[model samples]
Target: MNKAENIIVGISIGDLNGIGGEIVLKTFEDERILDFCTPVIFASIKSMSFLKTHFKSTINFHSINSINQVASGKVNVFNCWKEPVNIDFGKEDTKIGEFAIKSLASVTKALKNGDVDVLVTAPINKHNIQSEEFNFPGHTDYLAQELEGESLMFMVTDTLRVGLLTDHVPVKDISKHITSELIEKKINTVYNSLLKDFKIGRPKIAVLGINPHTGDSGVIGTEDDDVLRPTLKKIKDTGKLVYGPYAADSFFGSNNYKNFDAIIASYHDQGLIPFKTLSFGQGVNYTAGLNKVRTSPDHGTAYEIAGKGEADENSFKEALYTAIQIFKNRCDYEEITSNQLKKAPRIERKQRPN
Candidate 1:
């Protein structure tokens, strides 16, 4: 095929020892998904075949040597490597981490070169993925350096969306990192993401406080009152519907999160804990505010359930749907903006002057 009729979803198999294989194969096992998007898993055919059998999936893979052979309505597995590799289920190995990096790099290259429309990555063992060439804390950090635009780690489900002010940062340093500039950047990123990716108009964003109960008016800590409050106020003054400095503790418990289009958290656990509790397998970790579209399952590599059929493929499936939808939305936005520019209003001259 000269061009793909449907969007091409690039799959990067994360940690071989993790449940990445199970979830990836299980998601494609259902033939119905091929109707809208063509899935191209960036791994060897041998590895995919093994996973299909290991997970007992009935998926039939169309092995392709390159991206040009990727046809719609069938699952395609690009041969990233030909040689047989070791696969020990539930065992963490740095060697396995190397393969994860290989798959990620290959798929990311395909996305950057415009071969693939969007990327859906499986979970990786972040600790083992660190090396000389790839020292990223996670996929979001790595992608920010590789792709254009400011990246925000946006975790989303149908009803709820959470973006982090600080991701993959240590708890002790999170306070120092939540500066006015950082808070404003993350909030704007989330705001723009809701408009562009999620297709929401006039997005109302709420930001969680840095300290507990918003520092209880400087009793617990002053970062929330001093830093977060001022930054959010500054952003709100710009005519955006951004809110909060909300008490992270009671916001979700009281269901106050339902009032906003999106929520920005001070750090990782503060946002993800509530999000995962509410959505978990039903959610997708989307890297928003980027030139290229990328998403992943909200959960991490479940080493305990690696290669087991017990692993749920819901999150991975959701990630796939989210990526395809966002890609289309971005294209629509571009076309709409372009047409508006071309159809700009012109000033009419008076007939008397003529």
Candidate 2:
């Protein structure tokens, strides 16, 4: 395969002790995956080898010191750590957590340096991965801080796309954060993402309400009516096809979301609950509005099923494909728009014919 044609996918080995390594091994086990993009795993070669041996995986990968050594049609791994730490599968070890951060930081550097076209992150344990160097709730915030922009935690699939107003925040604090300004910001992010990343020219967006039954005409809660409604109106006034304060409970049941290009939830569970319910094993968690492309499986570190060879790789694989597709879509959009600008309008010459 020509290096020029391959999309280099940078993968961060999420928790070394979790199913991150197992799923990565399974995803690349089939060589056909290399047909679309080249995969670069940012982790210790030692740890990967240990997992491969334990899992009895037939997957073959090349270890490299830098992404510049990546080869098309091959699974290339950039060694983030040299030390051979004990492979404690399904256990929460602090050392493993530290290396996970190292791997993420390493691949993130490559993403910033333009060495990789996109990133597909494995799941990480939020608690264990916490440290002085990595102090975020999850991948969304960490990437948002590193990439610098409005980061909307977007869960997507072939069937549905859902975005969150607040990610990894506590339930009690959710309402305080659901202000008009915040709603406007996140809704705008979702709209732009649909247009650029998903390539929807005029995305029809549905914004979910914060309270049950959309505040029941202000009896249940007033945020939906006072905050979300006014904010959505402002968004629609700007010529965007945005609507909402829709009741989250009935939105999915009524199949109303089918009419919209994307749905925005006022909180984490509000949007993701329905999305994960419908597309749990196939959903891709895409971080939209970032400076670069980043995606991950909707599931987390399944410690109970980590080393059992029972962890499904469908979601992880979808994440990889989604990142590549979004990158391609953005490129195609830029070309289409740029070419349209280059094409001048036709000039009329009627009198000259006589």
Candidate 3:
């Protein structure tokens, strides 16, 4: 790993009563993980120590008050709060929610100040985290508001990538939310993320239909034909590589997603169900279209097996690697593009002949 590319990954311990701490500790259990990036976990050292004891982990960490004090090849825990935290493994309480927000806020501040290069957030409980401070639907929305950019809920694994056009909206409200303008906006975000973040020169994007059978020529619905079709045509006309308002039902079954670099699903369930089904324990949820790099495990707070030491860490590990890769990719893209933008030698006029 190039020293220049070695990043400081900022982690937010989400819902202390859940498996967030467990999965995070498990991911870093192998010291080899420290080879790629320096990790700075934004949580209380006391909480982490408690969890470590419970999990019987031999992993050790350094506690620091500031990001500048982080050491290379060591897991650093940023002391966000000094108060002792009581961990009730399988219980949900307002105190846990308050601590979760504190952790997230601390880490996000580090991220925005360039103290940390990328952020790999552990799973957060949406309902519990909902307070006057954090009233957003989920992490994607909160990040978008904090970073001042539109966020695409992009799910990623080795084989496929899925983006949601409408996120965290009710089923009845989904159709109203799926306007042509919204579709175009989210699709543009996905396209730009592929280019800048993922370093894809020309990404082929597949847009899924809102209704089954792609509206069946207006038999089932006209949203696919009227809204989706025209929007795709407009985007394609601009020389962007995009295709399809493909029927959602058969698109994944036919394995047609392989042909495209990314798929834009109409709604939350329409996209996430298939993605989770395909990549349950190994996928990363990437918040694309932000200037900063952020990703998280696809799974949520698994309270059922929180303290049992049975929570799988594969997804969390993948999230970390994915965040690192995206950070490197963005840096490489900017360097290459900046060099390419250098003006070529301008033709000089020969006045000697005149």
Predicted candidate 2: what Cα RMSD to the true structure? 4.2
- Decoy 1 TM-score against native: 0.95
Which pairs clash (backbone N, Cα, C closer than 3 Å) in model 3? none
Please list the Cα RMSD from the true structure of every candidate, rounded to 1 decimal place: 2.8, 4.2, 2.7
TM-score-better candidate, 1 vs 2:
1
Candidate 1: residue 300 Cα off by (Å) = 1.4
Reference-based lDDT, each prediction: 0.89, 0.88, 0.89
TM-score of each: 0.95, 0.94, 0.95
Off by over 4 Å in 1: 1-5, 346-354
Error of 3 at 9 (Å): 0.3
Give the per-residue lDDT of model 2 (tens digit) for 167-286: 888999999988888888888888888888888878898888889999998899888778888888887999998887787888999999999999988888888889989989999999
lDDT (Cα, tens digit) per residue for candidate 3, span 1-354: 222646899999998888999999998989988887899999988999999999998879899997889998998999999998878988888788889989999999988988888889998888888887779887888889888578889999978999998988998888788888898899899999989878889899999999888899999988888888999999999998889899899899999999999999999898999999998999999999888989999988888999999999999999999999888888888877767777556679878964
Candidate number with the higher TM-score (2 or 3):
3
- Give the TM-score comparing model 3 with the true structure, all chains together: 0.95
Our tally of clashes for model 1 stands at 0
